[model samples]
Target: MIYKRLEFKNMAGQKVKITEIPVLDSRNPHYFLVHARLQALAAFIYNNPDSKTSYSFHDYLKRKMKWSDFIQLYRTEQYSHNA
Candidate 1:
């Protein structure tokens, strides 16, 4: 859940008011169901660090994803579709 509030401030020599931003809590329902899998995801991350996977993302993607995936992700900001 998030709480919204209003705030007042002085900007450019003028007094201005703005709506306060909402706070995001990881414990929320959606977050808990989705993004809150931090531990599992962390394990997954640690399980497949540096684009390397032990058992292979498939068998093909592993060997290919190892260094090449890192390269693709780093240079192109995307995973190789082939991998």
Candidate 2:
């Protein structure tokens, strides 16, 4: 999931830092976690079956939902192979 492991300037021309931490979430079932900047947004991380590459996307929920609802939806969503 990490393309490069070095600190570099971001698009804003400011120095950005990169740190790699080994984190595991059993409830998520995925090897990694996908976090969204906004609570109202839904985030997903998808791993390609045939490659080391993975794809991800984030989108706003159709309607305002509770945290439990979001978790339930994510668990049922197609993108996540996790239970």
Candidate 3:
């Protein structure tokens, strides 16, 4: 897994730097699931400004998340906003 470093300004104007965005292999059976997870993570970061500096965000990405786990997190975040 080749990790890519990502640096961007969060919603709160804080610079969030992630150094472990995995470059998944296209031939992997779980490629789509992993891709979706990565997209969801990006959306999560964009939508929730507080996540910019959260320890959870930094730590969680360091360990690649399973598709189910990532989906659960994305859904939880969506529900929190709606509720």
Candidate 4:
């Protein structure tokens, strides 16, 4: 998600900078809106229940998403959750 209070370690075991994390959508390049990030993160978590903090949604969706469609998907999910 937005990782509001993040403090994760990177692959090299160095502390990760919050800026290194992206929201997995090219349209929302830098980061997704808080709520959208939350929903996407939730779906990812559900699908990968056994995983720990080893992967990011950005990593998973980078190739699966087109910039425009990704935005639409995220917005739709957000609306449904809050609707």
Candidate 5:
């Protein structure tokens, strides 16, 4: 189940709107991959002084981090750049 929209600020200080937040399902086959991606995102946000969001990285993870969410956001940004 995807949640409501959320906002995040990237390292460049741009406000990125995320429209989907997938519920975490540990039983999913790709759970580990998703978990690792989320961890990497969290670490990047935490380590980069310029990266920020409405909530802290920890809070964001607890609230909205999931495989589908990450993949959706990634594809959206990627396609937007190319278009």
Candidate 6:
């Protein structure tokens, strides 16, 4: 497993810490689970550092989610918000 530390600024401009772990493999069957995982992770990261999961956005993208799936989801959400 790959581990990393990441820092991100929320809308409030406050610096946050996130742990990045590459745990997902290509053999994983529940690909759609990444969306919920990402949402949960984002929520967890926004809280206290001690409460956050040991994973990062980059790691989530690389491990749990495919690039095309992420892009499609993002585009769909963006379009819905704009519409």
Ranking by TM-score: 3, 5, 6, 4, 1, 2
Name the best candidate (by lDDT).
3
Tens digits of per-residue lDDT for model 3 on 1-83? 35566677777788766555556578855567656656777677766887435333335643676666645434423356567
Two-way lDDT contest, 5 vs 6, winner: 6
Give the CA lDDT, 0 to 100, for residue 79 in model 6: 56
TM-score of predicted structure 1: 0.24
Instruction: Give the Cα-based TM-score of candidate 3 against the true structure.
Output: 0.54
lDDT of 2 by residue, 1-83 (tens): 23222243433444433233223354753332333322112112111122222212222332344566545545533556664
TM-score of each: 0.24, 0.22, 0.54, 0.29, 0.40, 0.36
> Per-residue lDDT for 1-83 in model 6, tens only?
44445567654556766665334555654344754676677676665455333445665666656778655533423355567
Local distance difference test, per candidate? 0.34, 0.33, 0.59, 0.47, 0.52, 0.55
lDDT of candidate 1 over 1-83, digit per residue (tens) = 23343322222223222222224465643333222333343344444434222222223222433565434323433458867
Which candidate do you rate higher for TM-score, 1 or 2? 1
lDDT of 4 at 75: 52
Please report, as a residue range, the 10-residue window in candidate 4 with the lowest summed lDDT. 14-23
How does candidate 2 score on lDDT?
0.33
1-83 per-residue lDDT for model 4 (tens digits): 43333454544444432232434445554345534654565554544444265445544445456777656545534455566
Candidate 5 segments whose C-alpha is farther than 4 A from its true place? 4-20, 51-83
| RMSD after CA superposition, every candidate | 18.8, 14.6, 13.1, 11.9, 11.3, 12.2
Mark the regions of model 6 whose C-alpha exceeds 4 Å error after superposition.
30-35, 43-83
Which stretches in model 2 have alpha-carbon errors above 4 Å? 1-6, 23-28, 34-83
Q: Which residue runs does candidate 1 get wrong by more than 4 Å?
A: 1-23, 52-83
Question: By how many angstroms RMSD does model 6 differ from the true structure?
Answer: 12.2
